[model samples]
Target: MTERQQQRSPSSGAGAAPAPPPGDADAESGPTVLGFAPDTAEDDETVEPVADGTAARVAVGSDRLAYVRRPDLVGGLLLLLAGVADAASVWLPWDRDGDVSGLSLVVRAVDAAPEGIAELGRTGLWQPAAVAAGGVVLLVLGLLLLRPARGHRVSGVLALGVALAVAAAVVGRLVDVGWDARSFGPGAWCAVAVAGLGALGALKAVLTAPRVTTVPAERLLVG
Candidate 1:
């Protein structure tokens, strides 16, 4: 070849190839770099976050029981009101007559002798005393119903006790001549019936009540 042709001969050696691009040091073993193997990188496993104090495990059953029944609470409150009314009758001082204000109504009802039964209205401290004792018992029982504890059996027993006490009071009232003219005075009958129904309600609440369980914290979260 001529000397000028040889000088511009593509500056090529006999058969040497171009050099390859530099390889990533962490590409194969570590997470892939951006734009490379993205699909495979996403599939890589990772640990989930956990609560600080509790373990990762949870119980689904207990979560359902946390909700309380409104009807049960209503029944319990009704019983409590009945107890208060019964207690008020002991100190209402109705035996004196003309004490019919809202506050004194409860007292008058207990000692009210009416016309015929004035002699029977003599409380001798025993009758009014017995009623007050029963009232205290009923109040305690009603409060127990409000608690989260299992009170089905306890409530039923308390209700029964209230019913019995009211019945005895009514019987005592019937023998005396008072505002109530009949052998069984109006007040006596009402007290008996109210206490009996209250007892039944408490017993029913206990018998039909469903079991409640605590819910786990994990179940509280939305999916």
Candidate 2:
């Protein structure tokens, strides 16, 4: 309260709070780039963010199909699964006794082929080798399609043909079973399923192929 002591009072510092250390503001906000220009406050103007991008510019009257690009993995995977099913059918049961799988059927036919023509009935010449081969072919085509490549249409067409051929084999063999019998087993149904899946996958592979191209583009900075 005395005049001399008033000069030393805490309020004598102009009644303002102590200034913080020079590094404290930068530390609290973020690191300051001392060597570069000082940063200005951020502008509040509206902006739409977009990256520098290039889009395919199609030629005049060009085929749109040629410019389109799509991944064939889905269709190819389906076809591959169909082929796997067909091959797996060889291990599944085909008859009431569960004794004759697709592979066994091929073996039996091969064994019977050696019998003389006169003993044809006794030998029972029946074969499904084409089905097995078709499955393998489809599997290969499917793999080709799944990878990045052109000519998917060709692979699809071939796959469709193979599927139809195997389908015929499946149906033809089913003609002999009577209603009273145990009828077609899992192997037979698997054959049918593969045929259907192969057809769909092939169609998709051809129709869903992607076409792509690159064109000049630029990025327009807003701020």
Best by TM-score: 2
Model 1, 90-141: lDDT tens digits are: 4344233433332343344445545334443454233444455566676677
Report the Cα lDDT for residue 96, model 1: 30
CA lDDT, candidate 2, residue 208:
63
Per residue, candidate 2 scores C-alpha lDDT tens digits across 1-223 of 6888867857547776887898977766755587554554334323443355533322232233334434488778988888888877778877756677888876766676677544433433242655667778888988888766654888889899988887776666665564333577777777777888889888887776456665433333444
Predicted candidate 2, C-alpha RMSD:
17.9
lDDT of the candidates, in the order given:
0.53, 0.70
Candidate 2 TM-score to native: 0.57
Q: Give the RMSD in angstroms, all C-alphas superposed, for model 1.
A: 12.6
RMSD of each: 12.6, 17.9
